[model samples]
Target: MSLEVLAVDDSRTMRDMIRFALEPAGFTVHTAEDGVHGTEVLDAIDPDVIITDINMPRMDGFGFIDAVRDRGQYKATPILVLTTEAAPEMKMRARNAGATGWIVKPFDPVKLVKALQMVAG
Candidate 1:
């Protein structure tokens, strides 16, 4: 089945890259600028998985995860943190905040697609 994804990041390039990586893989990709925008987009679509970056201008990934978890319908939605930060503590923090998985930045397109399929399935 094709998955619907929401990718939240501050960098335009990262969003475009996510779109490029997922779209041809048979996933429908939606993008947002930051946590606030991500929540706004979330209001409109119920994505199968949410991919967010750690650092952002308005609200960060942790906050975004919290917000997503608070929503009753989205509580079970898989949230994957995709960022350059690979600190152990950061991963734990994301886990505490309700993230389903984590991936380091400059991700391989094939691996990313595989990860998303693994998590969302």
Candidate 2:
């Protein structure tokens, strides 16, 4: 089966960028415009990996992860967070909330793909 990835961000540009990066690598990329929408998509698709931006409307990355983890289907899913915030505390919070890995923005496509490979593997 093809590996599926959920790319969550508010910006169309960011979401499209992530889709471009991951799709060429043989991944099926699904996108969520915001955390609220992400949850709805998650229920339907159940992507193998989730990469979300911290800042978003209608429920942020942390909220998304929290909601995902609460569900039986996604409890053990690997979640990678991408954010402009680089504070240690923010990282810690993400970790505490259940992120498997983290990346700071302005995102590097190569590194992101590598990270996706690592997580997907």
Best model per TM-score: 1
Tell me the tens digit of each residue's lDDT in model 1 across 42-66.
Answer: 9999999999999998899999999
Please report the TM-score between candidate 1 and the true structure.
0.99
List candidate 2 segments past 4 Å from native: none
| Number of backbone collisions per candidate | 0, 0
| Model 2 C-alpha lDDT per residue in residues 54-76, reported as the tens digit of each score | 99999999999899899997888
Instruction: Provide the TM-score for each candidate, comma-separated.
Output: 0.99, 0.96
Query: What C-alpha lDDT do the candidate models reach, one value each?
Result: 0.97, 0.91
Best by lDDT: 1
Off-target runs (Cα >4 Å) in candidate 1 are none
Residue pairs clashing, model 1: none
Residue 73, candidate 2: C-alpha displacement in angstroms: 1.5
